[model samples]
Structure formats: C-alpha cells, structure tokens
Target: MDPTLFSSIDFYQLAKREKNAQKRIRLLALAHVKEGKPRDEIAESLKVSRSSVNNWVRRFRCDGLEGIGNKQRSGRPVYLQPQQEELLRNFIESHKLSSDLPPLKGKDIHAFLKHYFDIDYDISHVYRLLKKLKITL
Candidate 1:
C-alpha cells in the first residue's frame, strides 16, 4: 500500500487545490507511505493517529486515485425509483395547479411518501430532493 499507486493527474490536481489541513495531512501521509516511510514515522511527522494512516492507506487500495477524496456516503441509498420520483413531482405539481390542496408542507410530503412509497425519510431529505429537482416550495 504505497501512495505511488494513488498518485495520478487527478490526485496532483486535488493536492494542489486542497485547502483543509486535515485532508492535506492525510495526503502527505500517503505520500510518505509511497516513499517507503514506516507508518510510525509518518504518524509522528504528521502528528496524527497511526490508525488514521492505516485507514487512508486502505482507502487508497480500494478506490485508487479517487479514494483520497472524501466520499458522500451517509446512510443506505433510498429505494425509490426514478419513476417514483417523477410520480411524486407530478403529484405536487397537480396539487399546485388545482389549488384544491392545502399549502405545501414538509410533513405533508413526508406522510405522502410513507403511504405511497412505503419508505420513511426525513423532511430535510425531501427538501433537498425537491431542490435538486428544481422544485421551489
């Protein structure tokens, strides 16, 4: 597990633009590891946990160049399909056009998704999904 394996054009570009101290330190640790420095030496020089060094090395092994970058994973992916998303959007749009529905509420949409999709997601997640769909509410 050497940083040489992680070094690529994209990795250099990321290293140049990267500003966070923790991320920079992580990258530097990988660089040292690629240069054949022992983990204990790298940890001492970077003033970080040896475990952190091992974790980043493992990530490099698994993801290659992109592994050095932070990933956006949080929870499991939502099970909804694209059609389901479209259906939700159509439902919201129809409600808006007819004015038959009450004012849009986060709780309202959450309940709707629960009943129709049988999946529970937070109102905040719904809000972000709506924003991504360019739906203003």
Candidate 2:
C-alpha cells in the first residue's frame, strides 16, 4: 500500500495533540508508515507487533484518519449521550476554581454526572470516562 495517503507532518501533529496513549501509538505508527519505513522496522521501533502496524496501515488506507478511531460494537448502550458529553465538557470548563469553590475532584464529577445526567458509573469508571473524553483529572 502507498503510505503517502497521510503525510508525515500531518500524522506528527495529530499524534502530538492526541491525549490517548493507544491512539497516539497508532498515529505514530502511521506516521512512520507514511515516511515509507518498513512495517516490521516501524513495529520494532514502536514496540508493537508487526501485524498491528499492518492493520493500522490498512485502516488508514481505507478510511484515512477516521479509520483509526474507536469503532462501534455490540454492547450496552452508553450511559452518557454525546449531547450530554458536550454539556459536561462545557460545565467543567465553566466551573473554574475560585476562592469560594475548590477544584473539582473525581467524586465531585461523579456526583455531577449522577445528579445531572441521572447516570451512575463506578468511581473507577469515572476516571476511564474522563480519559475517554480527553478531560484531565
């Protein structure tokens, strides 16, 4: 497959901005692939399996950047809807620390999600949710 579908510079910036570790690795692998590096060589350098590198390249070829993103699966529906997610991000951003209010903690965010969205996730999952949303703790 021609690896120039995405330029090295494009992948570099995308990987730089990506907060998720797995996605960042995939992005970097694609970047190397775009630079015409051998798949096995790129895999060894990235510390991932060669098959994974090949799969990522195939995904990029078929769907560009979007191909590397999380895919839909058969499972329970997400408790937090996409619109609610946007609202949650807005709410977090708006609630800045002040003399009266302290910085938001995981429990506080959990409470907020539970109260406002009427959804309850385990406290541990709350951290995972935050990471998935690219929101820092």
Candidate 3:
C-alpha cells in the first residue's frame, strides 16, 4: 500500500485527546502513517495485526478520521414487530394500572408472550426485552 495520510487532520493531537482505548490506538496508527511508517511497523508497534492496520489505513483513505472509528454493528434482530411491541407495551401499562399486583417478573412477562403472542423467548431475552422496552423490573 502507498504511504498515505490525510493532510487536513492532526492525528497525533486527536490521539492524545481520545479517551476510548481502541480509538486512541487507531489515531496513533494514523499518526504513524502520517509520518510514513510501514504498515507492518504500525501493526507491530500498535500490538494489532498488519491486516487491521491496513484496514484502518484503507478506511482513512476513503473517509478520513471518521471512517477509522468503530462502525455501528447490526445487532440481533428484534423478536417482535413494532406493532406487536406497541401492543405489548400497552398491555403492560393497562395491566399495571388495573391490577394491584407487584411489578411483573420476567417469567410473568414470558407467560404473557407465550400465551398472547405465541412467542417463546429465552428467559434471559425476556429480561433483555424488559430492559429494551424500559419496562421496570
């Protein structure tokens, strides 16, 4: 790869200011690249693989510093559709208002899901859903 660096940004200053460790390393790598360091040397000195260094450099070439930061991952898909989620949220609210019972636990929510929606979520995922929906406890 050609020794390429963006002239517009001061990567060393960015590296010094960066709080995230991985981002700091990426900025350091860019600073090295700006000083004409070899990819192998950047990788070795940065304790990352040469392929990783090359990937960062390629990203930098394409989109400057913003490209080298972590890309947002498409995490696991939602189990329920938006309408279904709205239904669930509304159900919980009405249930809470009408009933004198304590806050619903994960298993109660699990039972509701299985009985109403015919969806069987893992217990952990039931809690995750609760957290995602901002349903307290």
Candidate 4:
C-alpha cells in the first residue's frame, strides 16, 4: 500500500458531513486510502476509475475536501427576474379569483409575458414556470 495521502480521521469527518452521494463516496475512498488500502482496491470497491481515484487524491492534496465536491455550473439564466415572477404570480392569482376570466392556459401566460415584459418564452417553458410558481392547471 502507498503511504496515506491524508489523515483517515479528517477524511471520515468529511465523508460523514458530505451531502452529495458521489462526493461522499469519493471522501470514503480517500479515507480507505488513508487506512493503507491499495488504489486498485479502493477504485474497484467504489466502482470508479483508478484515474478518478488518483484525481480525487490529487484534488484533496491540493485543495482539501472542497475540491472533491461538485463544481458550480452555469445553467441558462432566468428570463424573468424575481420581481417579474412575483408580478406574474399576482396577475395569475387575481385572474383566477375573477369568475368572468376564462381558465388561463400556458399560451395565455406566454402572451402576457410577451406583451407586458417583452419576454418571449415557449409555451412549455411558460407552463414549467407556472408550475414552479404553484399555479394550478
């Protein structure tokens, strides 16, 4: 077995506190390595590539536990800001309360967004946004 890269106790604490399952497993693998287990054995048991194990160890050595967790990803930005969403929610709620207004559909919401906010979103995305806002069908 190679010399332990990190203290077993530190890795154990990190594994226990980690919320992400993949990161937790990586931490446990490091702990196993610190316990004098071979890299191949750790990789086999963890069902990950030996290279992955090596990378995890390298990251831990360089950046501590934080390096093993998921990196921040930049998803598509929200078209509507929070205030705009709140306004949309209020509009929907007020329309829902009025008996004269017909049941609002995704197209209706999309139209409203386009007319008022100058935001053009697909009907499916509008429905998804409505769902997120807790607007019922």
Candidate 5:
C-alpha cells in the first residue's frame, strides 16, 4: 500500500483548500486513498462508494483537477406540479402560524396543501420543490 500524498496538503488541508465542494471532497478522498485508508473508511469519510474511489482515482489520473468535480447525474425527471408547488409557496408566505412547534416540516406542509387545496404531493417531492424555489430548510 502506498503512503504517498496525492496533493500538496494533507487530506484535511486539501479539503479546506479546494473551493468546489465536490472537488474538495474527492481530493480529500484521494488523499486518504493514497495514504492507504481502508475502502470502508474512505467511503464513509467521503460518503461515496469504494467503486467511486476507484473511479475518482481513474478520473484524477486521466483528467487531473477537471474530473474531481461532480458528474451530471442522469435519472428520470423528478417533478412537482408547478402550479400546486407555487400555491404551497404562496400559502407559506401568506400564512403566519404561531405554534409550540418547529418550523413546519415539508410533510406537514404537504399534508396541509393537500387537505386545504386538494393538491397531492409526496413529502419528498415537496422538499425537491422547495429546493427549486431556493428556500432553505
């Protein structure tokens, strides 16, 4: 097992020095991998796959810094009905609720919209919709 450092800094320093989140994470993971960290440790530390470590190393070797960033993810388009999603946004803006409760969870808001506006939504879908609106949870 090699103990070479992949970048100028240690893993922690590489993580802090890199600007892009994905790139920083990958560099830190690469530093760990080069230091011969266990696959599970690398995966858990980086929240990526053991296979992803292999993939990252390949990308690093092939493309250098450019490939350390996120790849575009491909999947079925996830959607929330635009009109209903907007309605939820508007309702939250309009209504000021005071309760001995945490800020309304997405599920609670989803249920509220469904019950009052006859809008159907999965709770997770509501979270995605909120993200599109750039509303922080």
Candidate 6:
C-alpha cells in the first residue's frame, strides 16, 4: 500500500466521531490499511468484502476524507416548504390557544392540509410532521 494513500492524522479520530456504523467500519478498515495490515486481513477482521474495502480506498484516494462518509440520498421531498410549515405550525398553536376551536387532531390536520395545500399526506406522516414542527397536539 502506498504511504501517501493515508492521511497523516489518525483515522481513528474520524471513526470515533462517526455517527454512521458502516462509515465507521470503513474508517477503521482504512486505519488498519494505513498501519500496514494486508487488505485481506483488514477485510476479514472487519467482516466486510475485500471489494468494499478496495472501493473505499479508491473513493478516499479520488475525493479524500469526505468521500468516506455517506452520500446524499434522493428520497421523498418535503410536502410543505419551510415558510408554509411555519405558517401551519403557527395556525395550530393559535388554534390551541383559542377556546372556540376544537382540539386539533391528526385527522383535522390531514383534512386542513388537503383543503388548503391540496396535499394529501398519510395520517402517520401528518403526525410525524406535527412532531417535527413541535406542535403538541
């Protein structure tokens, strides 16, 4: 292995602070490789495929340390924009304070979103969004 492939600073520091388990293992594997351990030995000890170790090494070489971390995933986009979400949050909060309005429920929120935003979200997702918005009801 080329000595220049590894960073001068310890890879262990990156592994210690890594929140993702897969990335942490990859960092540990690279650290072992930096310590002059054979790729097969590192792979066996880490219980990952040698090809995966090879890929990690390749990525690190091409892009440096940031390459080892998880890439951005393309998942479902947020149904509401930040300002819209804030407006909805305020509406819920103000409704909570008003005696005339009934207690807000998941179904009520679901209906409100459909009526106003024309966005129909799952009942479970509505609750999740409310929790994310820190709306108590």
Point to the candidate with the largest TM-score. 3
Query: Poorest 10 consecutive residues of model 6 by lDDT?
Result: 1-10
Tell me the tens digit of each residue's lDDT in model 5 across 1-137.
12232444365776787788878878888788767788788988778888988888888777765667787889866445677667767767655454554676788778886787776777887787778787654
Question: Which residue pairs show backbone clashes in model 4?
Answer: none
| Candidate 2 residue lDDT tens string, 11-121 | 888889999888899999988877789999999999999999999878888887888887878997789889999988887777763446778888989999999999888
Q: Candidate 1: where are CA atoms >4 Å away?
A: 1-23, 30-38, 51-75
Which regions of candidate 3 fall more than 4 Å away from where they truly are? 1-5, 99-103
**What C-alpha lDDT do the candidate models reach, one value each?**
0.78, 0.85, 0.85, 0.86, 0.72, 0.88
lDDT of 6 by residue, 26-63 (tens): 89988998888999999999999999999998888777
* Candidate 4 lDDT over residue span 67-89, tens digit each: 78888899999889999998998
Q: Would you list the clashing residue pairs of candidate 5? A: none
Error of 6 at 66 (Å): 3.0
lDDT of 5 at 134: 79
TM, every model: 0.62, 0.50, 0.81, 0.64, 0.42, 0.69
TM-score of 4: 0.64
lDDT of 6: 0.88
lDDT of 1 by residue, 4-108 (tens): 545543433455678876677777787787667999999999898899899988887988756767767789766679999899899888888876667778888
Q: Order the numbered candidates by TM-score, best leading.
A: 3, 6, 4, 1, 2, 5
Candidate 3: tens digits of C-alpha lDDT, residues 11-76: 889988998999899989988988898989999998999999889878988887788888899998
Off by over 4 Å in 4: 1-5, 10-20, 31-51
- Clash pairs, candidate 3, are none
